[model samples]
Target: MNKRFIKGTMAALVSMLATNAFAATEVTVYTAFESDILAKYKNAFEKTNPDIEINWVRDSTGIMTAKLLAEKNNPQAEVVWGLAGSSMALLKEEGILKTYSPKGLDELRSELNDPQSTQAWYGNDAFFNAICFNEIVAQQQNLPKPTSWEDLTKPVYKGHIAMPNPASSGTGYMQVSAWLQSMGDNQGWAYMKDLHSNIAHYTHSGSKPCVQAGMGEVAIGISMASRGAKLKTQGAPLDVITPAGIGWESEAVGIVKVSDAAKRVVDWSISKEANELYVEMYPVVGHKDVEASVANFPNVQQKMAKMDFARMGNERADVLKTWSDKFDGKSEAK
Candidate 1:
């Protein structure tokens, strides 16, 4: 071959390699993680993979799930980073989730992994129900600190409480379901009936009830303990109470179908670096031995009720409907 021809071939190969290396891959991620933590998660991911940019669409769990379901036919999200496991199960049932187990998946607890053939979603961390009591407000109102779920039903707490609405918040439904599972259906209903009389409001956002309590809008707020602890650490004068028995949900991740871009994102999501980031925010990571605590997180993990994720997903719709029929749209005092 002529020298010029050989040089041209070498240059073509070099250009091809350069083009592949410089190609930017962007992934669209839909998540339910709080807005405050979005920047941190995004920045950490970007720091390691500068070539890939993450476009996050964050919202409350219900709204995010509904959006994903609505877009099922023509999926947009490449991956779901932090969402309720139950919501992912619903999506999996609809065949919208792509089953690709991430690296270090075996390190996760068995119960946290997907059992079905497709293995639709993976667990990141567990979030449980707890109460946020405004100590100052509770004392001023002469209210007794709540020690158990039943304590919230006392006549003393009447018209001084807030909780998430089951119809709108995943945490809300989980609490109701946990009660039914723990207290038995009949007793649970009875308990809720009594507790309902005291509820000041039913919030649409799962984390807002605690936020409202942290702000002293209500003397007591029923919400996720993680949010409560985080708030309390921020000088909210909020006392996070993990009643004797509490409901829990896992923050989960899943790859959305219909995107080659999403597959790539999921591939990295299950890697060691990604799990490390998850551990920073959530103490209970699925991959075994990645246990680390967030500041101000109490030893509430030991108190969590044994969750039945399969049953929860199977009966979620019925449970929500029953809860709505029984409590939603009803007038309550604040």
Candidate 2:
């Protein structure tokens, strides 16, 4: 072979490769998924669909919702992969989400997705609220382990409890909504008033409270059960406590109206394989066939509160406003 001919062929191949790389569909995804698992999810999706690539924009659920609303006029995200269902409902109300029923929609529990004639989003997995009690800190403070939600409000727990701020965290909002539904509106607010006195401070992210507790920064943290379980697995001297009735929220995915690539991403999101991956980290996945037994995590079926998710979504604005008026001033910095 002629050297010149070989060099020309190589140049042509390089140019073709560059063109193909540029032609690959890039989907911009917004998510409130935990930072530790974001890369794994992305890599798995890309591995299955090598023709499509994901560009993630991540933040806490509250922040992501506000940003999406802000960008209503000119949307930037192609899809929303891991945000609370309540947040997605709010986006649906704003007329931002594109209606899509993914391939495995029927396999999911009907209650997990939007029930309207035109579905706006589909659930992937659920996260439940739990108490993370640092064994070392509790022992040092001479505090007994709390087994119930009411137990945290006792005088002995005062100034030793850390919780997430509702205005900035989905887990916080779900807990507040669950309390109101389970305890009656009036009694729930009253309970919070008492609970507030015991709270040392409220953190910005749902996972932070548990992480702080695991580090012995606080004796107890009212946060996501998954975070507590993960911390405990990492050898944090913490006890993952699931109260009698626990607040929980589903994490869902939705497509924006813009871009053809969005549908491809949405389709992949609801696949059985995707649900299997979700269950590995979240346990409570949408697909009925998928089940996981994560260490230190409670059985969701036995512990989940009887929640009206739609009602909670509808009343979110009023609930957040009331909560902010009562407790926002007490929140610690992010």
lDDT of 1 by residue, 17-100 (tens): 999999768888999987987888778777777777889999988789889999989988878978887788888887778778
Model 2 vs. true fold: TM: 0.81
Q: Which candidate number would show the highest TM-score if scored against the true structure?
A: 2
Q: Model 2 — which ten-residue stretch has the worst lDDT?
A: 108-117
Report the C-alpha lDDT of model 2 over 46-90, residue by residue, as the tens digit.
888888889999997778988999999999998999988887888
Locate the minimum summed-lDDT window of 10 residues in model 1: 257-266
Instruction: Score each candidate by Cα lDDT.
Output: 0.81, 0.87
* Residue pairs with backbone atoms closer than 3 Å in model 1 (clashes): 107-288, 108-286
